[model samples]
Target: MRRGGRERSMGFFEHLDEMRGTLIKSAIVFAIFAALIGYFMKEFNEVLLWPLHYVQAEKPTLVLELGTTTVMEGFNVVIQMCFLGGFILAAPFILFFVGQFVAPALTDHELRMVLPLVFMAGLLFLIGASFSFFLLVPSTIRVSIEINELLGYTLRWTPGSYYSLLTWLVLGVGAAFEFPLLIVLLVYMGVITTAFLRKYRRHAIVVIFIIAAVVTPTPDPVTQTLFAAPLYILFELAVFAGARVEKKRNERLRAP
Candidate 1:
């Protein structure tokens, strides 16, 4: 159905059609960005591979001479990195399409929150990816290498594997960092109250620790804490954001 079909709700086929249209538009936008970014794959590869290079040069921990076991591995890594770069760069527009799809169903308060959230969402993703690249991924790799050494196995890691791991870790952390927006959205929609967040603060902290452990890939407490710290802070920020919006919503409700 169309955006404002109130009298007659959307049938299944109509919903499917709208979803298909949204997917097509999203794909077109992604393709354009991917093609442009793919042209600059070299620069993108350097950035993505920084953690590996840094660990190798600085620590001299392991002879992680990144190799290509397959004839096409080099070309494949370039393609993969290009698409990953394109996705990271194109995230904002992708979010815009998402916003467009959801805007019609939003209340005034939610509509107002959308722009800031969109911007924040992108910024948060970058921060998260940076965190993973600069610290978490490197530390995890170092620890893994140490373990392999202890087990008396030499690591002949391939380029494809390295970039694959990097892409997933960076993107995973980035996507995980969007949790505050979820919290704020819930508040804007009156789904949950500030009191609930406050009441479950301890439980939230425990869950955050678990998430940190899962995301960091390193077993050490320090590395886990590094991941957990920002997450806890983000959760607190979510609480404050939600509270502030809920207060505004309450004030507007009492307005003349």
Candidate 2:
């Protein structure tokens, strides 16, 4: 084991014990959050159904309702809600616990770097999830409704399918928002440079649009642009940050 810039010998069994404790703590936190979400399942259901509500309000002529084909569907949806919501709510605490477990093994400089990146990752995820919930999901749903109506199809989504879509959009976009962090890490490790990012900027933009189109679930160019715009901005920001890291690296290389 290591702590405060000093190392202490520890046996394999001791490490296993520490890991078991961390896992137990993490599981406890997750269970608590899951129970809390289950207790407020009605409110949580309303939040998940907000996009449908908004669309109905906007297009008063259209009727939209979520259904369940099987008796167990409702129960499954509840479980899905509780698990996903619990994970989201407990994510920060879980990360903190993992950080605590690993902190003693990391040098001070490495710990400092990792801590900020973890925090930034959490913040970016929240931003992306909020953006998806408020903007992307609704826009995609609206466009989907419009397209289906154009094809003479009425909108009748099952609870399982609807919630599955919701989870995919929210979590997918949130994960995508971590792209900049990956880029920064690559730059730090000298795997890619800022110049390469700039050289391929246009290509990256095209790829971003493609990804946005695939992820947004609608063919509407406007919605796709909305999804891609922030991602493009993040890519640029990554390039800028990578440039700084490159400069610092170069300076260090020349120092001695």
Candidate 3:
């Protein structure tokens, strides 16, 4: 009995230590990537501008202008973009570390389900990011630029502002895309049922559009459509995925 009690005490400390170590390591890795990205800010900035380069190249005065009143203003903006770029690049690693640290206590079946969930979440995020970069980004920038021309306003975009808009939209949409995966996983774990999802379907549609409007970077209707349409489709996909999970759960319950 004493041995069992002592082991339990030690196990608690061990878990705490493990969690601390994981957190520290994750932070360190993020910092390292941030520094590296900072060092290569110009190169990454070019990557961010590639879409703009292609779409707006016809306009000679299309430049992202930064107001530099401080000695280090340029450096500060570059460093900021680099940090965001690094975070984007390191997202998978961060997610993996989180999974490693938190998921071991789950059952084997849970682990199996969760691995695929992680993979699907990552894939969906990538798709969302791509959508933002290729379609939404170009479309919004084009519209904004054209609107400036139509309103007879000279628009000078700053690099910091532009990249902030870009990164936020990309990451935000990517995170949003994981909603379906979350719903599916919840159903698979038997935490939520398909019936509940179906019952709340209309309410979810209203909420989904609200979320889409908030999450999308541009307030324009076209960009909102680009963001919300995919989200609605993903919600439908989640319903289907939830049904599969429900089917599996019912099968297990019916097993001898």
Candidate 4:
């Protein structure tokens, strides 16, 4: 069998071979990125510690220090930092390879739709990660410092714990920014419609606030609002885009 004269049907082993090749390429890309990050570990360390610096700049009186409690903690943090940085840097290449492997199965129309969504997903993730790094993380640290001061305790954090918090918050918010893509996919699949989204707009707002509160490290309403506001905008945009997609789908179905 053939698909649009672009892809030929493959046997079990052939599919496995293609998959293996894709994985191999992705691994190579990841490894190269990891090595590069490891080589520049000092710069990467500064980037990771930016939130701490940001907090310090805001409040000169606050004293915060990051230390390693265990003998291997620094080494472990370095390894974690390298891998995480490497994966982030290599993600686009890996996605491209995966797309290439799967493209044979998609027709031109599907490819067009999928490629744009993939690009948008990457863009949204970057935006979300930047927001967390530049704003949310610093605010969280400041809040934590204030709370500790209130309790008459000095602020000190382990490198492992700090990196864990940084990675978790950044990656989690980045992933959460893919929410609109999921919404669009559901709309395309006929699982939901623009009307449905609009009807549940109020409910969605409540859920969005809930997610923001949960995702944010502090109980500060400002931080939660900062997180939720963009999500709400994206939700609205999704509803609009879904309406357009729904219209196009209906027109296509009605054609000839």
The sequence of per-residue lDDT tens digits that candidate 2 reaches over residues 1-256 is 4666566867889889989988999899999999988998899889889987887899988877788999999999999999989989989999998998888888887887899999999999999999998998888888888889999997778999888889989998999899999999999999998999999999999989988977887777998899899999999999999899899889989998
State each model's CA lDDT, in order: 0.81, 0.90, 0.79, 0.90
What are the RMSDs of all candidates, in order?
4.1, 1.5, 3.9, 1.3
Give the clash count for each candidate.
Answer: 0, 0, 0, 0
lDDT of 1 at 40: 67
Show pairs that collide, candidate 2.
none
Candidate 4 local accuracy as lDDT? 0.90
Query: How many backbone clashes are present in model 2?
Result: 0
Order candidates by TM-score, high to low. Answer: 4, 2, 3, 1
For model 2 the local lDDT of residue 203 reads 96
Clashing pairs in 1: none
Q: Could you tell me every candidate's TM-score relative to the true structure?
A: 0.80, 0.95, 0.83, 0.96
Q: Judging by TM-score against the true structure, name the best candidate.
A: 4
TM-score winner, 3 or 4: 4
Winner by TM-score between candidate 4 and candidate 1: 4
Per-residue accuracy of model 3 over 145-168 as CA lDDT, tens digit each: 888889988776766667777878
